[model samples]
Target: MPKRNTGRRHSVSADQIQKYLQEWFDLDNKAKYNKRFKRYLNYRDILTILFDRFPDLKTAYELKEKYIFFNRNTSLEEAEKGLAGLILEFGDSGIEEYHEFYNLLINWNKEIINSFTIINSRRINNSFIESRNNQIERLIYNAYGYTNSKRAKNRIMYCLNKKDSYTM
Candidate 1:
């Protein structure tokens, strides 16, 4: 889907579609559908309405959800098989946008599969590093422009390294 809302054309924005699908996935267990809504029934109704109005949106959402499911639940051994199935589904989806995502997965297939590894019951992933990078990027942006790389690095390290005051 396009980035803009495109209200008159009955097209949803990228953000809106992301919200809907993210709620549908409920990976974090903190999704709106889990807390505010009574059950899947309500979200199902909303999705039904959207799907009826824009069939392609439904296809795209389902296609994305399948990958989310596969990524979260599939074992390392099953990763290749599951990804192959997803690749076929993407090809069949007939939505051109999915091809780019499929290509990304293909390019990173080895790393993606390796990420399924678990150590001490924890999944091996780069979430912490990614979040830190995002925070540092935000700090840089808020500064309007950092002229000195060393100063920016020091500021980010200071912010990141400070101990939390809250007691557990």
Candidate 2:
């Protein structure tokens, strides 16, 4: 008999991955079902929408920025306080999903937040990301013909700035 794995040692079954693949397949199919259809919102897309509406999450961002970009002389206590305040602010924002995520944050705070403290000078630029995204969209449209092949569509997309393979 195989010894039972316990606690956090659970092994993933092939079924789980297959299920996720099928789920995404369904989502993509739905997205292409009609010309007027909107693609299903994934997690990051949903968060982007939320941030657009409620942009007052600066405290949360500052804590993340402090750890991610400015690690010169940050103490652990300061990081802890900043995270605690961010959690409190989110919880009190009257957002239902935020409260649930806040609970998860409190539960697994230690592991995920551990030294979320890496300092790098260079920050990412949105313009570059947008351009790269356009490049990828063009590649996809060309390779799979996901979008309409009208002259106007091709002209607009062809105007994107060039990118090297390294950017991908």
Candidate 3:
């Protein structure tokens, strides 16, 4: 008889069940897939947190804030200590990709770390800033009822060049 090779087995965890249950009960998630759409956050990490069945939104938010600090705020070496513990908490959970990311983070050479911590630290996400400009234009449209392009340009210039605005 020829030897047969079976593929890897897949088993769902209790954490998975708890998460789905929480998702089932979440009114915000039911009303709209809120966190599913945000671009600034890592959806996978958020989903990982969702699986743990938090007691309240406040606690969930604290986890999310920690995630943001870990993933985005790369300014301080001290800030990364928590990320190591978080990655280990999911030990052998079959998430090889997450493990790989953790490895990459931990194994990064000093130059690369310094570059991200300092050079890239000045970069802020532009989506919100651009949207705010559009919001100001819309406000001009609504507040002054300026339906013409000339008025829109003047309003934008006024808003952008005002002494109160940092651009000035």
Best by lDDT: 1
Tens-digit lDDT track of model 2 for 1-168: 965333233677999988988876553243232233366555445556667776765445544554444344445556667667666766766655466767876886675456554447432235677967766566665565545557445544555533522211
Tell me the spans in candidate 2 whose CA falls farther than 4 Å from its real position: 1-77, 117-168
Residue 153 lDDT in model 1?
Answer: 74
Badly placed stretches (over 4 Å) of model 3 are: 1-66, 72-123, 131-138, 163-168
Question: In model 1, what lDDT does residue 101 have?
Answer: 83
lDDT of 3: 0.55
Highest TM-score against the true fold, candidate: 1
Instruction: Flag clash pairs in model 1.
Output: none
Per-residue CA lDDT of model 1 for 12-65, tens digit only, reads 899999999887665445324544446544545666767999999999988888
In model 2, the Cα lDDT at residue 58 comes to 43
How much is 52 displaced in model 1, in angstroms? 5.6
User: Backbone clashes per model, in order?
Assistant: 0, 0, 0
Ranking by lDDT: 1, 2, 3
TM-score of each: 0.59, 0.28, 0.30
Model 2 has how many clashing residue pairs?
0
Error of 3 at 111 (Å): 18
